[model samples]
Target: MNAPAIDARKWMPYPSAGGAPTTLYCLPHAGAGASTYLPWRKELQPDVDVVPLQPPGREMRMRDEPFENLTPLLNDLLAAMDGVWQEPFALFGHSLGALVAFELARRLSAGEGPRPAHLIVSGRRAPQHPSRLPWIRMADDPMLLEIVRRLGGTPDEILDDEQMRQTVLTLMRADLGVDQTYRYRPDPPLDVPITVLSGSTDSHVTMAELEPWAECGSAGVDIRLVPGGHFFVVTQRETVLRRVRHCLVGSP
Candidate 1:
């Protein structure tokens, strides 16, 4: 089935200033909108363009229905990003975003396109291992709230507001549904070099769990332990961006 047509540019609200030699396409963690990485442009511009992808049902795409499965979500992304893939680029995704980025990288590697130079994944276990995290797609609303609150990214004000809380939970469930339903199919290892970043104290993903990522990429995988937990992508923003820049541009 053909994925519905979407204005491709809408996915990137903060495009590079057009002077960078390469681009970094970023995918957000579950329940997160692209705005989460908005500050990245300043961190990696001229050298690399930071483009964060905004999935539906979040931020400006709030009214659009979110995809509950990874296949259609990726299909839509592939269709929408047809032109954007022409340039020299890399991918970075955190948590659920990590899985999405990994799958996307595999697709690009197998298909016709300029494959990403690097794949940077954070706070998610390698696909080869079964996810140790709880499957929260079917959890009740209160449970969902607790899970989201425990995850530590969503603002307290949003959770406190009735309408806002509903909106957040709806997006979270749909995104988590994508995670719960995803079944990783074996494929040849990716051609791109991969950098796996894990939080030192991440409650969901341990340092040991990141080891299997080496098998997923033939180009070589570099795994590093940084500070904080699953939400370290935000809490340790500078550290994350620095590592990402190092991976792609060889800076510092």
Candidate 2:
């Protein structure tokens, strides 16, 4: 018999509030999971419902294998998030998530799905720029741990346990692999507005690297420099949410 089909609904475990005017689909950074955006619900609710996309191999989907390439992951997400395209929605992603959001927006613009109202990307260089970080799978375990340490959003429990540490490293390798191997294909400019959020002190992504987002969006790109390093999506949460709210709901 054929194996049971994977239920994509599990990718969006959080139920919508029903009162929101629009939905914001948030994707997480490397080594992180959907739960990273869970707190955003309280702040964006009643106007913008926050939907966190949980990729395989982390949190609730821990037993499933993560994608080691961007193509397959994007293909899976396009299929998994089919319902989201039918509504008024926007996309937000940080670091590895940024590439995912950008590609998804591109696919939607190509008529694979309905276009998102806006695309907000954080903590990553524009796709045309070469990645600054080395491929994690090629690095030794200690080096991988050091790289994760410098990025700084990982929880201590996973880092402390030997087995858990190895598991997380595998996940991170798969996540970074998606980033390190991505190739940007030139496409017609997207009609959607793009918002690029950069950390002022983020060594990983320079302002120069963030500026090219303007070329991708025909509607225009808004670049905001927030205070923090790499993980500003977490370090400066309120500021990011305020801007996101302003974009989607006309709120402060």
Candidate 1 worst ten-residue window by lDDT: 129-138
* Predicted candidate 1 versus true structure: per-residue lDDT over 1-252, tens digit per residue: 976677787777766567788888899998998998888888777688888998998888998899999999988888888766637889999999999999999888887456888999988998877755467765899998998898777899999999999999999989888888888787889989999999999888865678889889899999999998878877898898888888888997
lDDT score of residue 172 within candidate 1:
90
**Candidate 2, 69: how far from true, in Å?**
0.5
The alpha-carbon lDDT assigned to residue 116 of candidate 1 equals: 88
Clashes of each: 0, 0
- For residue 126, give model 1's deviation from the true position in Å: 0.9
lDDT of each: 0.86, 0.86
Instruction: Give per-model CA RMSD.
Output: 1.9, 1.8
TM-scores, each model vs. reference: 0.94, 0.94
